[model samples]
Target: MQKPSIPRGTRDFGPIQMAKRNYIFNTIRSVYEKYGFAQLETPTMENLSVLTGKYGDEGDQLLFKVLNSGDFLSKTEENDYQVGSKALLPKIAEKGLRYDLTVPFARYVVMHRNEISFPFKRYQIQPVWRADRPQKGRYREFYQCDADVVGTNSLICEAEIIAMINEVFNNLQLPDFTIKINNRKVLVGITEVIGATGKEADFCVAIDKLDKIGIEKVNEELIQRGFTQQNINKLKPVFEFEGSIVEKLQFLTTYFAQSETGLEGVKETQEILKYLDSYKLENDHLELDLTLARGLSYYTGTIFEVKANGVQIGSITGGGRYDNLTGVFGLKDVSGVGISFGVDRIYDVLEELDLYPAETGAQVQVMIVNFGSEMTASGLSLLQKLRTQGIRSEMYPDAVKMKKQMSYANNLNIPFVVLIGEDEMKSGDYTLKNMLDGEQAAYKINDLISKIKNSH
Candidate 1:
């Protein structure tokens, strides 16, 4: 006999944990729905070709590949067995668990392009699998709550995304945070102006570690990554110039005035800022952050990352504009921008801050005590009545000790308990006890339902 266990990176959620998780998902879903984004779902496994090359090299390495069924290794040659996964993976793995919802979504749009309307806005809340090393606040299997608007390059969509982020965090009652906004084009423009356009990937990858590695160490990393002294000199201003976001933008506008792509990004950012102003989201809540480089290869325009102030968690959420993600799937010129809420990380933050509501548990508003066989029927009847009245009520399956049933209700944190012993059943009334304050009152079943409903 084998022991029962799950994969290391995966988690098994218990009832209480499920309740808390549902609170998070429902909060984000409600906000997504409010923004006119329809819900969507993609399969757990997608074709390897569909997922490959969408994320960066590092991300692709972390994807969980599924082995082909039915003698997967039967076709592998003896000589090919010694090679690395690069040469051997194709022979064994035909499918892969989805790395993220966004890539599968892009594939979805291309596959269903004809059936769907243009400028499609959709939201997906699904578990994605990764093969990364597990740690606190990092998992192999985690849920991503994503909302994206594709087929449109409108800045209004970007503003709406920011608004949706605000609404989600606000509804969750998360403490003050910053929704840092940047544009990938601006980073590209910086590389171009620095005469390192060919090394843009290396440059961005190095600077993306600015928070983890100091500026001097970043310059050293860039040098190690094959950047020239002249390019490093040009990049120094970005780190050295410290001021408000508007001042930094002013500097960028002056520096990259001639680059059309850079100027277009500026215009798009201006529109976003204008729309945000119309919505009045400016302040510490929404601000321009020049240092945000979302390391993903797909982002082409506006980029975003959110960080909570006074908390020590990583980016709680992030996403950006990708100009032509669907072009790889035979659809060209369709642009999209979206954000992903890192639900697990957010859960950690909320737990650390003690922000989760106390009442987050299974909704057993009332538990009916089971007496002997005679009162069991009465208790079941009362349970049905309470349920019919829109109250979440349950009863002990067996007629056990009164103390044992009450203990069960107490352990479950049920707010109220109903005693349906013989005396109460004969008197045509039920004893309703408030577990919180230990107050008891006797009332007819009808009046009891009404009182619970009205009081709640």
Candidate 2:
């Protein structure tokens, strides 16, 4: 028989893994809520029309398209196959697993335009899929914790989003991280100044790879993409510019003096930065990065990317202002800004840095040990009482060996164990074992509840 295995780039999270993941999700959810973002959910699959052309050519290629059900090939024309995927994809696959939360969100807003409040604030925590090659911190199936506000062009949303990012990592106790901010308009301005106008998309695609491929390689890519060596030579100074946020913004002011569109992007970025200062994020944690041209074609204004200072991973969080995203779906002129927390990558960073608190793995507060059928009745009564008092307690289902039952509790990382026996039932006190130090003490029902609650 062939050994059973999950598809590559996917994983089956065990109890402990689930517990840690929940920690990350709950932290993000709490922050999203505190900032007035309500929870929202989108279907796992979105129409291919809704999913495509919004995320740029590369993103469209990575979409996990679903085959149309019930003899999918029956409807296809013989000539469509000769023309290839461009002609055949829509015939065979009308739906695709959502590539990200943002696009699906735009679709939702358009579909329910009248149902939701304008400048709607919503947060969605759910899995997204991609067909790209996956490695550490990148997965084909993973969750994105997203918070967004639509139907407004306010830069306050951008500032608030950055503040939320700060709070999330701060709550997670991830101190060493940077929030890199940039503007897509500034990128356009740079292209114009360097005489690379009309090649904005190509510039973003190449410059976005600067961190991964380094400058020399990036210059090579720029050349390959039809940029002149003069254009690259002008870009070199901008790439290597070192300064504080003020200095960087100043540099842009002078560099983009002649490009009106570039100056507009610069102004929008300045407004966002000014609004963010009152939030008082830590020194150097928020930075102005000129080279941060977020590759998503939809982003029209301020763009943000976050990196864990010490971890060797890609951006843990990123998002930007999409002025025309909803407009693409027929909600004309509605603009919004948002951010997404890459949960898989965040979990990887937490694991590598040992940031998760010790209590994260202890899901159940106490486990009631099972002796046999003889004592099962007393155990049942105690279990119900503990649960009624809001204690997370469970009992072993089987009348297994004492060693075996304790092994189960240990494996589950149960912090405490409650023992009720003939003697204890008669005495009206049960022995509680502290799993950490192997200490045993007798306690009544009320006392047991207090101890478990206090300890955990």
Please give each candidate's TM-score. Answer: 0.96, 0.97
User: Tens-digit lDDT track for model 1 on 149-249?
Assistant: 99998889888888888888988888688898989888888888888877767776787788777888988988898889999897777667777767877
Task: Write one digit per residue (lDDT tens) for candidate 2, span 204-274.
Answer: 99989989999899899999999999998888779889998889888889998889999999899789888
Q: Which ten residues in a row have the lowest lDDT in candidate 2?
A: 276-285
The C-alpha RMSD in Å for every predicted model, in order, reads 1.7, 1.3
Q: Model 2 misses residue 169 by how many Å?
A: 0.4
Superpose all Cα atoms of candidate 1 onto the true structure and report the RMSD in Å to 1 decimal.
1.7
TM-score of candidate 2 to 2 decimals: 0.97
Question: What is the lDDT of every predicted structure here?
Answer: 0.86, 0.91
